[model samples]
Target: MAPRANPTLRQRRLGAELRRMREQVGFGGSELGRLVGMSPAQVTQMEAGKIGISVERLRTIAATCMCVNEPLVAALSDIITEREKPGWWEEYRGTLSEDFVDVAEFEGQARRLTTYSMAFIPGLLQTGSYSSAVFAQTFPPLPRHEIDLRTAFRMQRQRVVRSGTTPYAAFIHEAALRMQFSGPTVLAEQLGALIEDSEQSSVSIRVVPFDVSAMPSSSGTFTYAEGPIPELDAAQVDTSLGCRIFDAPAHVARFRSLLARFESRALSEEESRDFIGSVMKEMESKRA
Candidate 1:
């Protein structure tokens, strides 16, 4: 009834671009509605990307927005094609957070990903037990079913590495390494896994040492992803309410700055490898 209640990134993008173009033309929503032979509310919904427009109608709207250039049309066509394709994550609906699904879908299509985590290891590097521990801490009273579902969702998301098509880079704070979520054994196992994952040629892991007090990203974790097309980049900052996604150049630039600052303080790959091994050894010492 509500147009299937789902839209692909491509569809969403095409709809967003069209909405932006419409607003740029100085036509009031009502006026545009009059022009497009739709109601003012419908025009607003269309511009807000709550619904889709047929190709012919989209072209007409583009013409009205004065963005009828061939290149613009070509980009729209590309988005449509992408939207028409079925995504792999669609089957996991109702089980994962909408934010999780959105992030995963975007990551799947992304060509590159950069993330900074000061409190915990980025989700990509988290082991199943580590993830479960983190989630438990967040929703300590959640039902077992919900916890299992969330953990499973996270593991499924980790399949990004298994995909072997796109690669990502992660930077974490040394504090994250020291923060023991589970008992020593679980923490030790997860730390060991991080070292193994870092061995992959495509992924890069760096750690900002505890002494680096001036590093950025002290507020919370955030991620930036670049799709195959530069124009498709999206930045996400985590918040207690949920994730806030930023596509504007200004926001993305700020996140990039945070990453650069953290990178400046982070240990080199070899140094981090040593640090990881050392942490594992410490866990072993505790066992002994």
Candidate 2:
């Protein structure tokens, strides 16, 4: 088969794992190629995710590299098989940035999602108006048609929540809760929806109050998308530059640790609901 123009993160991840495994075992491209019955060029193509690898070949490489982790092997196999399936986000290919589509595709496949946001409501929980307000504030501002497309795209991403099967935990700071994205009414609706959504068995929303003594030293927003197995777990963080996906063992572990810290410091789920309710009431009073 021909090479993919743009491989999904999961596809790249599989290739990356193969390369890492081989290197860790001191196997070179030609050496590994001989063992896998592929030429060095073919092995390079597979490792670059420019081409696909058969499940049997992948297992051979894993075993040759001395990787005995059954779960990891199974996870890789699953990813290889799943790669052939097209994702819903693929429909937006020509319209949105590849990074945005990648994020959506990642969310769809994630078994569980944990996110922390300080400046704005996390996208999964954001209301239509709130998200529009956010896009409206973007620098070099987009055209109206573009803004509408982005808003719709974001709302589409919330389908995972509607499914009510994927586990989601959002750690939003009080500052984000207090910010009136479009206006008091919009923010109020957003917070109210948050409270209601928190009641879902699959969703957990926690608030980090301003009174908290310590906060995550690192700032900005991030989402940790857990995979079927630890090896496939990844963290997506947005920066001024653009979105970055972290999947290295060390990077994933650090993000996981940071999320744990936020979870411990944030309010209990019940308390958080009450806190949001109180904020909604305050918004009402201000508007009155």
Candidate 3:
């Protein structure tokens, strides 16, 4: 598949650029709001991508930014004029959280992905049985239809992973391997899938062993996605307030520091495979 395109931040940056240019011309957001005939808070939201812009507003923004070129005006217009949402996610909109859809598109467009999983194996690497069993236990008395939908969505996520173009690095906790997603058979298949996935030249899978004594990820799962522009890239975490996106350079830098600590503590792909294989064998021994 071609690289996925995520324009959300791009639109925000364009708006921010307009704000900065207006400021450079010595106009505050309120002053620019006067020029655009919109409220200051609306200008702020425009710069933040919380709202879209109309053609009249686009023209006003271009004028306020002292932009004379038709191309610049059209480019910003394109951001708003383009109505088509990515096909992969549109159908699932009502079923999934906004963050979930946003991440899917972001991952599609991302050139690099670094992930850490302390709980169960990260959903991106989960096999169907692992996904189904995880969700089954998650929501009590989950309807069969919901279970099926989640399983399908998870499998679709793995498609790009399997294509091997997106460079993915994962540091998974040792406990995730021992945590039974299903019976021994289901877990055996999941482990085997992880081993197989780790062999891909573009994908790196690491395990943080219990014996490691400590790892940076006692916190929670986080994903750091890299993009063409540094500021446009992001580090995402599911915080107490729920999933939040951090694109600010400092926040992203902090995540980088944490990830470095994690990667350094994790086992290499070969070692991780060996560790999981051992666990699988131990499970078999128990069954025997």
Question: Which candidate leads the pack in lDDT?
Answer: 2
CA RMSD per model (angstroms): 2.7, 1.5, 6.0
Cα deviation in Å at residue 119, candidate 1?
1.3
TM-score of 2: 0.95
1-288, model 2: which lDDT tens digit per residue?
Answer: 887888877778888888989998999999999987899998888888889988998898999999999899998998777636587889999789988898898899899999999998999999999999999998998899999999999999999887897899999999999988677888888988899899999999999999998786765799999999888899999887678888889999999899989978999999999999999999878777
Worst 10 residues of 2 by lDDT: 79-88
Number of the predicted model whose TM-score against the real structure is largest: 2
Better of 2 and 3 by TM-score: 2
Q: Global lDDT for candidate 1?
A: 0.76
Tens-digit lDDT string for candidate 1 (100-133): 7777776776778888887888888899999998
Give lDDT per model, in order. 0.76, 0.89, 0.76
TM-score of every model?
A: 0.87, 0.95, 0.78
Candidate 3 has a TM-score of: 0.78
Query: Which ranges of candidate 2 are over 4 A from the true structure?
Result: 83-85
